[model samples]
Target: MAKTVVITGGVSGMGLSASKLFLSKGWNVMIADFNKELGEKVYKELSSKYSKKQVAFQQTDVSNATSVTDLKTKTSQLFGKVDSVINNAGIFTKGALHEVAEDAWDRIMAIDVKSVYLMTKAFVPDMIEQKAGTIVNTASISGLTGDYNMAAYNAAKGALVNLVRAMALDYGKYGIRVNNINPGPTMTPMFKANPQSVIDTFKKASPLGKLAEPDDIARVMYFLASDESNPITGENIPVSAGFEIYSGQPVQK
Candidate 1:
């Protein structure tokens, strides 16, 4: 039987890129995102190329249990079983700890950190029963280190990284592998919001001398989701193009 994958926040950005890669590999894909317009748009685009039965979408608020439960049910109904899950749904916040408000902190944790818990709670049971599956969480380089003025985003991602580790340890015995993909500043909708100078600075800082494209990240995710990586678990792998070699290394004046 062909494989099936459930991708959260799969309507746009790196998630959308991952969706395309999985579909190209002949996998049934069920995408869940909060953006109804983008979700419908992606559904139409993919369904045009692949069978509608092989692609489905749900407008889901990942932070909500009800929405997550519905997503789980719909995915199972459409594809029968989920062999892989990409917990790529998240938001970024820019602010120092003192500057961020309680509401912003709550929202950051909800979408970035808590959603992982909710998703795992909803989906891992079947994987356990089947004794097989892969879970890939989108963490960040910032989670390992820290970025200026991004305390909330840093904290949430850091939590997600460790959560992947802890869960992998707990579930690996059941043939469920959990790992994290730590992407650097990628050229996604989220990073495109940066000013030209900011983008230039980041490009200069990167060892590759350019920001990553979404496919650059998706390809790594695809590998992790495949059986070739069955031996890998609890690994927080970085796809940062050597950004961590030393971020913002002195630029020529």
Candidate 2:
């Protein structure tokens, strides 16, 4: 029997690429996103390309406990036992500490951080019972390092890095692996929304002279979910084109 995976935010960007990758690899994919229209559209598109039974979609608000529970129940009904869960749904916020709105901070924290807690709670029990599972989180380089005028996003992602570590320690004995992928300025719709100067600056800063594509990030997600990385857990691996490796020093001619 083929394995099954649940991917939040699976309608677009990196999540959409991951959904495609898993389906191509013969895994049953549950595409969960907040946009019902897009979810159904992508569901139809994917169903046309692959086995209709191999793909499913659910309109989910990952930040809410009730919505997440509903997603878990739906996945169980549609796919039986989930072999993997990808916590890839998140919103980005940017502002100085004092400039950040209270509601904005609350929303970011709830979506980026609390969603992980809710997902683990909802899915890990069946994983524990089966004695195996994989959990992949779509974090950012901001989680591992600080950025100017992005206090809320940085804090939320930073919390996720440590949370993955704590979860690995708690769940390692149960033969489950938990990891986060800290992508560096990928060419997703979210990143492309920035001004051209902003995009150029990020690309120039990267040693490879380009930002990552969604497929680039999705490939690493696939690695963490595959048996080749069975011993890897609690890793905040960056798929950024050596963007985080450069020091702020000026390039000498």
Candidate 3:
């Protein structure tokens, strides 16, 4: 029987790539995202490429505990049991620390951090019962370091890094693995949505001479989710293309 995997925010960006990779590897994929249109589109596209039984979608608002619970229930009903979960739903709230709105900070934290808690709570019981499972959280470089005009996003992602470690330590005895992937300046809808000048400036800052693509992060996720990384847990794997190692430098001309 094919292993079942659940991915939140699986309709776009790195989440979408992870979903496709798992499906290609013969895993049955259940993708959850807030955008019903994109969710349906991805499901249809994958279904056309693979069998309909190999792919599924559930409209989910990961920020809502009830919605996440419903997602888990529905996934179990369709796939019997989940073998892995990728907590990849997240958002960026752009604002400086002092000027950031209370509501914006709360909202970002709820989606980026609280969603992980809710998703883990909802799925870990089944994992414990089965005595095997993996959980991968999509954190960011901002989580490991500070960023300008990203107060809420930075804080939430930073919390996620530690949360992954704590989960790994607590659940290791149960045969459950928890880890985090921190990508730097990935080329995703969110990055493209930024002003062109801002994107250009960011690209020049990276030591690698360019921003990361979604596939760069997705490949790391695959390793963490697969048996190839079976002995690795409670770790933060930085997929930043050496951006983290670069010192302050003039923009590439």
Candidate 4:
């Protein structure tokens, strides 16, 4: 039987790209997202390409335990055992520490960090029963280093990076793996909303001199989910195109 995977935020951006990649690899996929319209649309689109039996969509609010549980239940019904769960649903916010709005802080933490906990709670038990599974998170370079005006996002992703580490330790004994893919500035809808100057700066900072496409991150997500990375867990693999390698010094011509 083909392996089954659940991908949150699987309607758009990197999540959508990853869903397609997994389908192409002949995996049974359940795409979970908060947007019902987009979810149904993507479900139809993918169903046209692959068999309906191999693809499904569940409208989910990942931060909410009840919704997450429903997602797990439906996915299980559709695909049987989930071989992997990709926590790719996330929201981004920008502001200095004190300038950050209380609601923004709470919302970002709830979506980016708490959702992972809820997901693990909902799925890991079944994984443990099966004695095999993988969990992949969509983290960011900001989690590893500070950003000028992104305090809340940094803190949330930072928590996620460490969460992956802690969960790996807790779950690895059961033959489950936990890891995150930390991508630099990617040209997702969120990045495209930034000022052009800000986008240009990110381009210049990367040695590759360009932003990552959604597919770029999706490929790494696939690697982490596959048996190819069985020995790797509790790790944050950077798909940043060398954006983090700079020392912040101006190069002398």
Residue-level lDDT of model 1, residues 1-253, one tens digit each, is: 9999999999999999999999999999999999999899999999999989899999999999999999999998888989999999999888999999999999999999889999999999999999999999999998999888999999999998798889999999999999999999899987899899999998987767998899999999999999988799999999988887675557779
Model 4 worst lDDT window (10 residues): 241-250
**Per-prediction TM-score:** 0.96, 0.97, 0.94, 0.96
Root-mean-square deviation of candidate 1: 2.0
Badly placed stretches (over 4 Å) of model 4 are: 193-198, 250-253
By TM-score, who's the top model here?
A: 2
Clash number by candidate, in order = 0, 0, 0, 0
TM-score of 1: 0.96
Q: Which residue runs does candidate 3 get wrong by more than 4 Å?
A: 195-197, 247-253
Q: For model 3, how does the per-residue alpha-carbon lDDT over 193-245 read when each residue is reduced to its tens digit?
A: 99999988888877677888888888888899888998999999999867777
Note the residue pairs that clash in candidate 3: none
For 1-253, candidate 2 gives per-residue lDDT tens digits of: 9999999989999999999999999999999999999999999999999978999999999899999999999899988999999999999888999999999999999989999999999999999999999999999888888899999999999999899999999999999999999998899997899999999998888879999999998899989998879899989998889877766678799
Candidate 3 backbone clash number: 0
Q: What is model 3's C-alpha RMSD?
A: 2.4
lDDT of each: 0.93, 0.93, 0.91, 0.93
Superposition-based RMSD of candidate 2 using all C-alpha atoms, in angstroms: 1.3
Better of 3 and 4 by lDDT: 4
